[model samples]
Target: MELALVLPIFAIVLFALVEFTLLFYARADVVEASRIGARLATMPGITQQNVEAEVKKILPPQLGQGAVIKTEMGKHSGDVVMVAVSIPMTLASPNLLWPVGYNLKGQNLYSETRMIKE
Candidate 1:
């Protein structure tokens, strides 16, 4: 009887673990995408749209669709580029014990690099 009572709690914890793992993977993808975009943005003659396209291509299929990217040019007289990437993660269902659903937000990944214009 005690085992039966504990089984559901164990199952929910397991599900949450799986969700966290997925979120970590998505974070890695975001970092990779930001790096690629920053690199491309620094390249001479690379249009903003082209850089965005390259960055999108680097992300995983599911992430590419939902990913949001914002790029900013350096204000000073140097080649400093900034890229911010955000991805949303929605839970499959509400926790068996919680109200409606517990939404865990994905972290925003950002990368900044300075390069010599070629």
Candidate 2:
């Protein structure tokens, strides 16, 4: 009887831990994608369109669809180039014990980078 009572809670905690790990991985990927985009923007003659295309290519398929890329080019030489990437996160459903589903769902993961134009 005690085992049965504890199993549900244990399972829910495990599920939540796994879900959070996945979320962290996704967040890191998004940040890396943004950094890549910013680096590409720093290259000579690289347009915003090119940067966006490259960022999408670098991001995973699921994130690519929902990803938003924003680029800001420096007005003058030796200035800074900025790239921002945002991905919407949908949490795993049927969360039995934790409120993570409500807290994480529909939230956006974002990353931004700035580098000097080269």
Candidate 3:
């Protein structure tokens, strides 16, 4: 009886751990994508739309859909260029025993990077 009671709890913990790990990995990818976008934004004559498009191309398809990219550029050369990326991810897997979704449905992971315009 004790074994049966403990097994489900253990399995839930294990699944939760795996799900959190994947969430962190996705967050890291978003950070990298933002950095890539910021680097592109530093290029001369690059539009905000172009930078966002390039960032989307670098991200995985699932992440690309919910991804939002924002860019800010200063008026002068050597000015700061900032790029931010946000991705919404669902932490709870339907296959898991407990569907403990975050913030009702999912959480948004955000990343921002800045560089000087060249």
RMSD of each: 3.9, 2.5, 2.6
Q: Show the colliding residue pairs in model 3.
A: none
- lDDT by residue for model 1 over 15-103, one digit each (tens)? 77776677677777778888878777776677778867887899877677777778875444456777777766643222232332655
Write down the lDDT of every candidate, Cα atoms only: 0.66, 0.82, 0.80
Candidate 3 residues lying further than 4 Å off, grouped into runs, are 91-106
Tens digit of per-residue lDDT, candidate 2, span 15-49: 87776777788888889999999998888888889
TM-score of each: 0.75, 0.86, 0.85
TM-score of 3: 0.85
For lDDT, the strongest prediction is: 2
Better of 1 and 3 by lDDT: 3
Q: Total backbone clashes of model 2?
A: 0
Q: How close is candidate 1 to the true structure, as a TM-score?
A: 0.75
Model 3, span 28-117: residue lDDT tens: 889899999999889899888889899999888888987878889766789999999887665212234335543324557889999999
* lDDT winner, 1 or 2: 2
Task: Rank all candidate structures by their lDDT, best first, as comma-separated numbers.
Answer: 2, 3, 1
Residue pairs whose backbone atoms clash in candidate 2: none
